[model samples]
Target: MIKSIGTDLVKLERIKEIGIEKFAERILSPKESVVFKTITNELRKLTFLAGRFAAKEALFKCFKKGDLTANYKDFEILNDENGAPYIESKYTKELISHITITHTEEFAIAFIVLEYAEYK
Candidate 1:
């Protein structure tokens, strides 16, 4: 069953102004940071950073993080062999998550769907 849905939009220019390297380190998990460092193109790297930020923000909207606070690092996103992005985190063991991210010349947008299932 569908548990929740969330979406987030981010301006690419805003990401640029903040400096991709600084933003990437702040939001990207250690594994993500390693892949990000290998990218040779500035635009692709920026887009990657923006997409990750938007994705984390969207995922944050899917559930509450309790009274402690929200930590972007809690959600880790990675791409598969086909270049499809997927979520990897200890927090999502019982939930199924679907996400899609897109970027234009000026913005990055992400949509997320969270689902719950029972073992048969």
Candidate 2:
């Protein structure tokens, strides 16, 4: 069953001015940072960071107040063998989360749908 839906948009130019390095440290999980570091292209890295930031922001909107207290690092966005993005959140392991991310040259946007099993 669906519990909540959340979406966020971020401007790439704002992230560029802020510097991906600074925001990456603030927003990315350790595992995510490692992956971010592997991208050699600066534009790709910036887009990646923006998408992740928007993703986490969207994920944050999925919860009710007091559902949990979480920082950006607690939400790890990862890919499957098929390269489909997913949210890996230890705090919400019992709940299913679907994520989609996309970017234009100027902006990055992400959406998340939080779902629950019948048990929840």
Highest lDDT, which number? 2
Q: In every candidate, how many clashes are there?
A: 0, 0
The parts of candidate 1 lying over 4 Å away from their true place are: 65-70
- TM-score, structure 1 vs. true: 0.93
Candidate 1 lDDT at 9 equals: 97
Task: Please state the error at residue 100 of candidate 1 in Å.
Answer: 0.5
lDDT, candidates in the order shown:
0.87, 0.89
- TM-score of the candidate numbered 2? 0.93
The lDDT of model 2 is 0.89
- lDDT (Cα, 0-100) at 1 in candidate 1: 82
